[model samples]
Target: MVIGAGPVGENVVDRVRAGGLTAAIVESELIGGECSYWACMPSKALLRPAIARSDARKVAGLRESVYGPLDAMEVFAHRDKVVGHWKDGGQVDWLDSIDVRVFRGHGRLHGPRKVEVTSPEGERHVLTARHAVAVCTGTRALLPELPGLPAAHPWTSREATSSDRVPERLVVVGGGVVGVEMATAYQALGAKVTLLVRGGGLLPRMEPFLGEHVAAALTARGADVRTDTAVSAVVRDGGTGPVTVLLEGGDHVEGDEVLFATGRKPRTEDIGLETVGLAPGSWLDVDDSLRVTGSDWLYAVGDVNHRALMTHQGKYQARIAGAAIAARAQGGDSALDTGRWGAHAATADHAAVTQVVFSDPEAAAVGLTLAEAERAGYRVRAVDLDMRSVAGAGLYAQGYRGHARMVVDLDREVVLGAAFVGPGIGELLHSATVAVTGEVPIARLWHAVPAYPTLSEAWLRLLEAYRG
Candidate 1:
């Protein structure tokens, strides 16, 4: 049985059924999960037009043609289309086609291998899993506890991404992916946007230079990117009026809407973890195969396990967990393969976690950064390059300004990590992901050459910088 029928849960059930196991999946909300309606799909849909226009304006011939604000209605319509009109009928059909039983309700654990589902109509159903139960419930937006903040009814990622009408003026709190992307989208759609970052800079998890580059670009595009700022209080008339965000320094920012895109916490609080000897709100601890520690029949995949929060990473965990569950079910303990990169192991979570932040001058990275590599006790050489030096980048954009960095593990002679910040680096990340995951040697990488007059040539330049 798989609880929380998001993409991760759906993938888990798919793998389990492929391994010849009967499975049932349960979801309380939309079957396709957050990514479908409120996250990856809708968010990307809203950002793509602005991104495309930016890309076009960078090109010489197209620069003269592209100008002005994006059609807000058109963008919202496209986002609606991308989210399938916020409906799950198609997802349901696909799940049904796969022969997985679909249960619509809130699913909670009723002790070992037992699930109790409460339907919307006040009906209840109990399910027993003979083999294993996988928890694939993801996370929710975490709002900071400020006095009267809840009363102000601020937008989280959900409201920010799925909102049909752009706020006239948006004050976005937090400088992470959600905050930056929503700020960028609304700014492009004609909203006066002010991004408040409590930390030193934006995209703080990536290389510092990446954050600097993104911050500069956002500023160039007319966003008030304020760093080292925090909100201390909030005021709204009746939870639906203009929001006044009081800053830490006694000043306040008033806007038509205020968004707290702070971060996310696991959605495990109400999922019945306490019934099975686990804390209700705590993150679930799991082994490499995604099995809950000390429990053979219970598994936790996706954000609920706190392994990795990204959608793609969660789906990868689901595949591994599903395979492990099937093996343990069919052939018992002896059939399990728990070695690193084994059939059932989730090795990439530890070594090659990849992230792409879809903001202007997009930020992308795979594996560990220079600090991470050094802290891991690896002898490392970090190489940096101005991405503008790449011939392809110049051709792609006349005055292309960006940076790329590669962290090499000297002892292993392999790339430990890579980061790219530029107009079109989102597509460049997977190559780094492959290099890190495959542990591709630097010598071998020299021969797998990137074609000229493309952003990919940045890889060749990094290699050259490393050799120098």
Candidate 2:
């Protein structure tokens, strides 16, 4: 049994059936999870075209000349197409093809191997899993305490993704991925955007150079990006349009929409976890097999587990949990070691998970930032470079002030982390992820060729700087 038809849960069910096992899936909302609907898919779908347009303007200087105006309606229609009109009929068909049972409403554990599902029409069904129940219930937004916020209606990522109307002005609170992505989305949608970031800079988890580069890019794009700023109040004065958010330090920001792109919380409050001896924060604690800490037949994955929160990471976790469940059902060793790829092996969550903020002049980092590298007790050597030397970047972007950096382990002669910030660096992130995860040695990495004049050349340059 799989709870929450999110990317992780859906992947688990598919893989379970693929391994010739019977599977049942329960979903309270959409299939394909938040990424498929709200978070990754819709957000990126909105951002990608804008980015392509931005790049076109940068290279050919043809902003108004070549592309006169974009139809947001048409654009949204295309996005809806990519999302299959926000319908899970295709997903349901695929699941049925694989022989997985589909149920609506919420699902939770009743006991060791039992799951109780509540349907939308108040129908209840109990299911007994012969192998295990993988919990992938995902998560909910975490709203901060702000005066007047409740009374004045605010849009979370959910509202932002689903809304057909683009507001005149959008004030985004929180400078993380959601905040930045939504900020770019609204800005591209013709909304005057003021991004309020509580931290000193956007994507503080990334390298400072990347953050600085992205800050400049967003500023250049007319986003009123402000870091070291916190939201204080939300006021909805009639005729004043919609929510007006008061930021810290006496500055006032009013917007037709206020998006709380703040963070998220595990959906632990209402799940049936407590019924099975779990505590208040009943996001099931799991073992190497992803099996609940003390129970071998109960496994957990996705946001509910409080692991890595990205959709990609969640899918990987699902694959691991599914494989473990399959092994257990087939009388294979169930001592699932996450590092060994059997027990919800999102090993990258701890070892190295690359994060990319897809706004213009994107920010990216894999493994650890310099600060984290040092704190983790690595004797780290760092190098920074302007990405202009890369042939592809120079040709693609004029007046580009791109930057790249590498955090190296002095003892191991290997890169501990890397960051690239520029117009097209988002695509450059995976190479770093490969280097970090593959533990490719620096000398050998130098021999590994990057296509000439390409943004990939930055990899070679980073290696050169590291040696110096």
Best by TM-score: 1
* RMSD after CA superposition, every candidate: 0.9, 2.1
lDDT of 2 by residue, 1-468 (tens): 988887888899987887779999999887777878877888878888788887887775565563655568877887787778889888888888888889988887787788888999999888999888888888878888888877777888888887787788888898888888888777887889998888688877677776777777778888898888878778996534777788778888878888897888788677677777887555666654566787767788877777677787777777877887886677666444545422446567776777888888788888888899899999988888888777788788667668888888989988888888788788888888888888888988999899987889898888877777
lDDT of 1: 0.91
Question: Per-residue alpha-carbon lDDT of model 1 for 273-323, expressed as tens digits?
Answer: 988999998889999999999999999999998888899999999999999
Candidate 2 Cα errors over 4 Å, as ranges: 61-64, 237-240, 281-283, 332-344
Clashing pairs in 2: 392-453
Report the CA-based lDDT of candidate 2 relative to the real structure.
Answer: 0.80
